[model samples]
Target: MLRWTVSSTDSFLIGYNDLDNEDNWVEADGTQHSYSRWRSSEPNGGVLENAVMMYARDADDWIDVNVESSRQFICKADIGASAIPQPTVNPSCSNGWESNGGSCYYFSSDQKTYSQAQTQCKSMDSDLITIDSEAEWNYTLGYIRYRYYTRDYWVGLTDIGVEGTWVWENGGKEPTGTYHWLAGAPDNSGGSEHCARLDRYNGYQDASCDGAIYYICEDDLYISDAPRSIQTTIQSTTSAVITWTTPLQMDSQNADLIGYKFYYWIRNKQSETTQSVTISSPDTFELVFDSLSPGTTYEFYMTGYNSYGEGVASDPPGNFTTVSAQLRSENYALNIYRIAKGVYLQSHVIFSTEAITLQHCTNICTGVLSCQSVNFHHKATTRAKTCEINEGTRESYSSDVVSDSDYIYAGL
Candidate 1:
């Protein structure tokens, strides 16, 4: 197996063609070295293969290879007198809270339901812990293993809003990278396991939200400022455009502003099926939502995210309603205004019959009292041309209507 050495790049060389010069050798950290362990004819690739690697098969002698090539790499760490320094509790943290990576964590001894645990965290001005990165996850797992080895703890991960789509309490989706779920876990057994818990034996498993379990809470030191100047515009009957400005105090935080997360939900709906979209570019301040239901009002908000996690959502969420459908005309003579090319109404078929032409199909639909829409299909043979009359209109069944090259949908 090839392994990387503490040397790379040929930009420091006095001349590009000087392969035998030891003066050109410099560590990745810019420390000059005169050490010579090169194999015969090594370093001949010069400009192209600038990185040096130790050849394990050839007496561990060094060889030059392309810096971009993937290989096992060795790292060196500096050790001091106090190799592992004792952790000091943060002064700002409350009693019994431990600090790591600029965040304070509290591991509860009392078992509570997921809701109760979140309430307790809210009382302390914190939320259930969200493991944002691999370092945080490792630290949390290690701390739990050492301090609370026999117990399962609840974190702020759940899919209660949208089943099978786990989200952190901070409103970020479960990251695509570095998630730790045991094999065949999160089965959502009995269809009631909407919450996630950290198992002592395994990684993560879905559990009933009502089941009592210990929990962890976190208080971050560097919370990001929320976005401002949120605005929404109704673009059409089924779409809208939302815009917002970047947070005013973004540079005050130590982390970079990576992106923004947009949220929307129907207004006055009991279930409140909220959905979120993550824009991974900090420069993007606007987004268009096209899959909205007509005549429905929706609330919108946005939050900025970074390496730490999601910040607070913008205040005073914008609300907008899509344009409502016009009332059907009482006179069927004006039905030509409802005809749409390359569209087909799905289901609710009142009757299917052969028609001589597209005009004949419309006339047949006009004669049927129950027909609100008609789908006319074109065929090579005149006798094979067909018409399907439906009781539903495109405005009434917007989701069911689809585009098709062979059919024309006309509403009466």
Candidate 2:
């Protein structure tokens, strides 16, 4: 019996096939080849295995194999050696840093605590690496493993601010579905582990912030400037549209403009209640907000972002008020009547003044052309009375009208 030097399963495809006729081989690109090297009785599979492969177990001789079979193949380039571009040092990055995906990365040679690493990065005008997407994570992992091998690297993730709530140093909360932690990791073991590090063998693991480790630094190539020319249009009684122009200085070469972040709330109630929405398209310049209270005023501002980070907000937020439901018809007759007691319409004031009685407030509303409602605030002890003329009626802005014991609402 003869012993084989190579495994029986070890085979590699050669770019030659005879699909048209048996024993008539041709190159993969449809050209004929005259050179022939085949194992004895090899073209046996015929039509079923028209492709040729080199079988290692049979002294690396050519054999017919199924064309659809998965096997490693060889490749040859037609270009001359000098035509291929040679790798050159990237001018955008510093001496020891590497440029990738429009960002610069620096793998530190010295070990330091997480805080020390962050300080070192900041000294160089960069930050400890914050992996934003899976592609970025994979690239960092591959680079470290290939270059440094099996080493722990400090990353910019910590829950020190609020335990179990990991946030980047830049204050962005950890986004879901973007990172995979090592199994059962970030356990905050012994109530002391707060910093995160990349373990080359598995994934991220929580470690003590004081523990020394190698680190990676990242510098963003560019960030989008703030959006410009913010404008708003009332679309309906319960809906409004906000539009803005793209920033003029947004760069598309080094980094990609990802989207815009919109911040809005009822004016004067921003500290109490604010909402934000992220429009995840670079080309979108408008956003529509529905389900708004009729005649309620809203203040909004927008900021653009790229893969690096969010930019500054648009200066001086724009404001708009939704149209009143009853005011949709232009020909409606003005007839003032008592709508509700202990109620007032908020944030649609056309004018306000002191009034001695409820009837005096109604008379003031009748005189103002834009006034559709009136709120009379009366104090029994001080004998003080005030009137608020509103541009929205109680029927049109029911949601904006709220109960207040000292006020009365009258609609036109």
Candidate 3:
């Protein structure tokens, strides 16, 4: 049987008759499998006529063969898989490295300094490997399994060539996620080159880019990515939160995932209403978003990424709804008093307590028409915490407000 990594993109050529289009290839025994096309002409015999037959265009006289004729046929992949060859930059001087994020990197640790390494990576729309998360740290550790203490591999994270500012080949200068250090690394040692890397044993380390170390590069793709594992919880009349996971990391040329991009929708007329949200930096498997409209049904899902490209979104996503305020927690001290005519919500902070941020207030004012107008004590660490929700239509205060020492908002 022939092996194939069928991209969902090029399946049209194979026709709808292909069995792979139906579901994940798994047998009753739970053995996963993939499909390969047999030579058209070969599968041409038998009353079932299941033997491969030559494609009409390529067959010419072969098409005249009797339906029962037995002829050896050659296989040709109708899918674009056999189309153009991927362009390679240094196919001769460089070797390929398979990244945990599902990408390919090419590095020549034989080079002496960083300049050459940058040049090589640049030639291929990529740069030296830059580690970002613990997942990535583990991914890199396995990639260099063949190489010993030998030398430090070159990563794209650096400030030396630019000084004071560090930028990765990933288009942004700021570091995302958590930063790690191998106790005392990126020291520039004697002040030469300062490239960052994840140590296999522990922490991050800096090395000269030109120091003869194998490296990795990245690729990125944002188009055609779908959302996955969607879950929705509708709380009250004005808001909801959507959560999901991705199939492959975004922009991954290869390596563990870095972050994700989310897109959501609500059925509109005969179509779905669409919107996008980017969670710039997050770990694998989870995300929480609250601030959707009340009583509106929404579908949410996400796609993953690393430094290179994005993969497809998940299938069989879930749906959710936003309930009414009547469905909210009456346990919020059941404070149902009139702020002005609009009847607003206010959580009493009994003491100067925990620190709070605007995100907390925005979350509280779920489904508000204007979340931007809310005022929150972003750094409040005491009972001073307060978020003034702008209801637009307010009435004079007619009742005493209840106290909520926690002053927290509800999402469900």
Candidate 4:
């Protein structure tokens, strides 16, 4: 993989040298120097040509050039012990994350404010997508056009901290490639447009932070082998909620996972079903399975799918039994209400930091699964504001440990 060339004014030393007083040459490795192919009058001692060199244009011609003169050189290697094989894993991306060139990207279907989108991406262990290469930029533009149909996406480039000083999400300087900026771009139009997005024209355009738009998240491809550590949390007579840790991919692997394949079957039954759900964002990892017989046990496993292929399936399927039909009832609240000064119902369905209002938390929880109770900890001027949706009535959590007295502890 390497080539060596000596300077024209100086010669490079090889392993061969005249070791004996009689001008008998020998190599550094003690090999007999039996080969000779000198050029016409190459060994002219008056020129002090003690070292040797091969003719640059000929394959076999040799010349006794100056020891310090520069010329082409060749190297040889002997086979050594067998090299140790490196460990390799089937690289893949997590559900909802697309793989591309040593990275996992997630384009959010749910739109959010610029700050909210950045927070959401960070919650999923990623940052706003950065377009560092022409290929990456073109691919992003094409993908956005195909999926969003002329819609815009928030890119990581911004000059908010210092006007006209654009920087990437990872604190890198401006990209060296093409900016693809639209005409009159970063015009500082209104003097408030600091954030940037990939516009429909495949150009980088500055926009206001308040504009709600789908964003992109990028992280290293180091997810696990598959969706593992699955657990069946809550189950009714006909439905069950399953949660699992997200799948992981290796750093050197490329995975373009779009979603997950949920596999389930009734224990000891011949029938089975496989359902696939597209994750709207990288933050989603739970799914609810419905329409099951009462008091029946079911086993389930999951696998992630991407453009490359399907990843390894879960090792052991999670098992859960639904309650009896008589034991199921809809006796929970569907709205957010104040439970106590510093207490909240346990058995939460999901948690979110962007849920700013009680209604927002209620709507998010009620749409997913059976929402019994909900809590909204709204504290302005702080990032700790959150929404917690309670599905089961197990116990209550102390509000002091979660929120302050000014927090809005609502339950439903």
- The best candidate by TM-score is 2
Candidate 1 Cα misplacement greater than 4 A, ranges: 1-85, 175-179, 224-412
* Candidate 2, superposed: residue stretches over 4 Å from native: 1-79, 86-92, 174-179, 224-301, 305-321, 324-412
Model 3 steric clash total: 59
Q: Residue 332 CA error for candidate 4 (Å)?
A: 94
For 263-338, candidate 3 gives per-residue lDDT tens digits of 6777552254677766666544444444556566766555665455565555544567666443346664244322
How well does candidate 3 match the true structure in TM-score terms?
0.33
Candidate 2 worst ten-residue window by lDDT:
327-336
Cα-based lDDT for every prediction? 0.72, 0.74, 0.46, 0.62
> For candidate 2, lDDT tens digit of each residue in 95-202?
999987767889998999999999898777777887877778778865663355447899989998999888886555674243378767778889999898987553
Worst 10 residues of 1 by lDDT: 10-19
Best-to-worst ranking by TM-score: 2, 1, 3, 4
Deviating ranges (above 4 Å) for candidate 4: 1-91, 175-179, 222-412
lDDT by residue for model 4 (160-183), tens: 899988888655566323447877
Look at candidate 3 and tell me the lDDT of residue 395: 22
